[model samples]
Target: MPFSLSIIAEAWPTFEAGLITTAIFCSVASVLGLVLAVPIALAQFSRSWPWRVSAKVLVEIVRDTPFLVQVFVIYFVFPATGIPMSSTVAGILALTIHGAVYFSESIRGAILSVPKGQVDAARAAGMSYPLTMRRIVFPQMMGYVLPPIGNQIVGLIKDSAVLSIISVPELSMAFQNVLGTTFAAPEAFVAVAVLYWLLTSAVTLVMSRLEQLTPTHRSTQEMTSLLAKADR
Candidate 1:
């Protein structure tokens, strides 16, 4: 059977709303999650065992559990504990927490990759810890981390669709509504799929360009290998 996307035009308003919502969700979650992830990543390398353990446990719990279950707990179960939240708020919290766990690992790896001498130089130059990190460490770390960070962001963007399950009316829910009312499942899903692809591909392109531009070459061979893969 030939696939058709013509039906999507009539349903564009719903699709537009869902697309906007997903974009907002991902933009906020990525920023907030990365911010929250920094400390979690740093805690892993802290001298204090309690900090390490707490960070580790939070990461493990998020990594181990299914995201859908986490969403359900936040949306459905938490209300029983008297902490009321809108579905949008619950979805935002769930997505941010979940992505932060994964983002933290990339952050940890990047931190470990930063050269000791650069950090020493920053300290010796009278830079405060926060300033040293902001000026030297994070800038350098992004070179190493940006690709993986991009991967995580793209995954999180796709994963945001799952929020539709709790009634936040993101892309997937928008598609579902179109399907239910118009019975045009193919067109609705095709449109959603294309939109998701465009969004993810844009990130991949930006990150790939950044990876090439950034000087994270701890091992020259690794960069060469990545370039070769891109050529393929």
Candidate 2:
């Protein structure tokens, strides 16, 4: 079948709105996920058993289940229990909560990757626990966390399509809507896929630049080695 450019052009407005909504959901979820992740990660690594166990349980429960089930629980089950949320709100909430679990694991791993000597050195310098974590550990952890965090963000962008099942009007929903009206399935889906590719590609590019700008341990070690040699 011959492909017609006019179909894409005509569907642009609907797709644009869907893209906007998807972006908004992702932005809000990313920020909220980060906020939720930091505390859970810290708790997971806590000296206290209760805190660690609680955090671990939460993470496991979310990770082991399918996201679709989680969405249903949030949208349908919650409403049956007296908490009603709009489709968009439910989609964002489910995505944020689910993403938080995965992001928290990344953070915990990053924190663990920090050298043991660094923590001991900070403590020896009389730095309080919070101060040490804030200044020394967190900075180092970022270098480890960023790459995986970028991957999660890309995953979340793609996963947003699942929200269409709940009637969230995301990019996939827009494509489906256009297909329903025009019966141009191929054109609509191709356009939507391109939009998704653009969004994810933009995220990957920005994150790659950020990773380059952020100093890693390898660079720090090289700098330190150079300084030591200069003293000879």
Candidate 3:
């Protein structure tokens, strides 16, 4: 079989459109997911049993089910409830919710990872609970949370492919269309895979740079303090 650069060249416009759609979906979902996640994470870490239980149950339900099922439920079943949404909207909603559940867990874990003594110190300093969390805990937790959040963002990009099942015209759908038109499955898929690889690598590179720019860990701080004291 002859190599066909024309197949890719012809599909470029469709692929570019699909890439834009996928990026938009992922960007919206990531922001919405973070908005949903913070409150859920707070609920999960709350003192009230009911709040924690409800949050946990919601997280468990979302995490246990496959994302494709969630998309189908949102797109198909939601219409019966008198709330009609387009496939793209439903797909975005599903992806956002799914990502929120996982991201909430990451946030909760990061918050809890802060030493209890830090919370106690804030309390002893006469800081209100909310103030203490805002001033002390949150800043520290962000450093811990960022890496996992970056991973989830990458996962969300890949998971956006599932939206094509509902006709969202994402990258995977564009690849399928190319295959249908040109009968070039391998080349089309190869191009799609390379695009995805580039997307993920870019995310990883950005994340690594952010991590390096962030402050050093507690141990590093402690070691630095000790060195300063010795020098003094």
Candidate 4:
């Protein structure tokens, strides 16, 4: 048989299901990973030696190793150690850990980019540490971080394909299944690639919009006003 779009049309259902799974895994992992990154990033600046050391070691280990190796260890090794997890759980966990460490570094860099003078000023104005972070540091940090964070999200989607090794039923696995039956490697792979591109493209579009709308100055103005009031 010759190359045809019919093969893609027939396999649409499988592809669609796989795309949904991929979306869910990436979506959940992205949110959890970024949320988790905040504390990990903050921990690096903790006054306690143990907190700083632990966070540093974790960031190093996760960032240095291959994500594929991490996925394998989570899926195959942890179960034997009495921490059993389903494939779905394992896949999401691996993605989350991978994303968190990378996102933490980006966050740490963003935090550093915020001028120390601003923080000192906030403190001089009687803002508590938490209050300063909430109203001063975090707002300014968001603009610097958003671009890198957007890139990380795009990378995370691509990384989710590795989950197929553990039978997570994501896009790659779906295409693999279709290929197994149809043996149309070209059509199966092309379709999967296109879907991945589409998914990542959509995420990029949203991130771009967010970057444009980032209220860095407005937030600073509002927080500065609040801080001024507190000073008074």
lDDT of 4 at 4: 78
TM-score of 1: 0.84
The pairs that clash in candidate 3 are none
For all the candidates, what are their Cα RMSDs to the real structure? 4.3, 3.0, 3.0, 5.7
Clashes (backbone N, CA, C under 3 Å), per candidate, total 0, 0, 0, 0
| Per-residue accuracy of model 2 over 31-127 as CA lDDT, tens digit each | 9999999999999779999999999999989998889899988999888888878898899999999889889989999998887788899999999
Error of 4 at 152 (Å): 0.7
lDDT per residue, candidate 1, 127-174, as tens digits? 988898888888778777888899999999999989998899888889
Which stretches of model 1 miss by more than 4 angstroms? Answer: 116-128, 208-232
In candidate 3, which residue ranges exceed 4 Å CA deviation?
Answer: 217-232
RMSD of 3: 3.0
Q: Which residues of candidate 2, in runs, are more than 4 Å off? A: 217-232
lDDT of 3 by residue, 1-232 (tens): 6667788888899999988888889889989999999999999778999999999999999989898999998999999999989997898899899989989989999988888788899999999989998888887777788899999989999999999999999899999999899989878988899888877788789888987887744534566898999999
The lDDT of each candidate is: 0.88, 0.90, 0.88, 0.92
Report how far off residue 11 is in candidate 3 (Å). 0.7
CA lDDT for candidate 1: 0.88
List ranges where model 4 is wrong by over 4 Å: 218-232
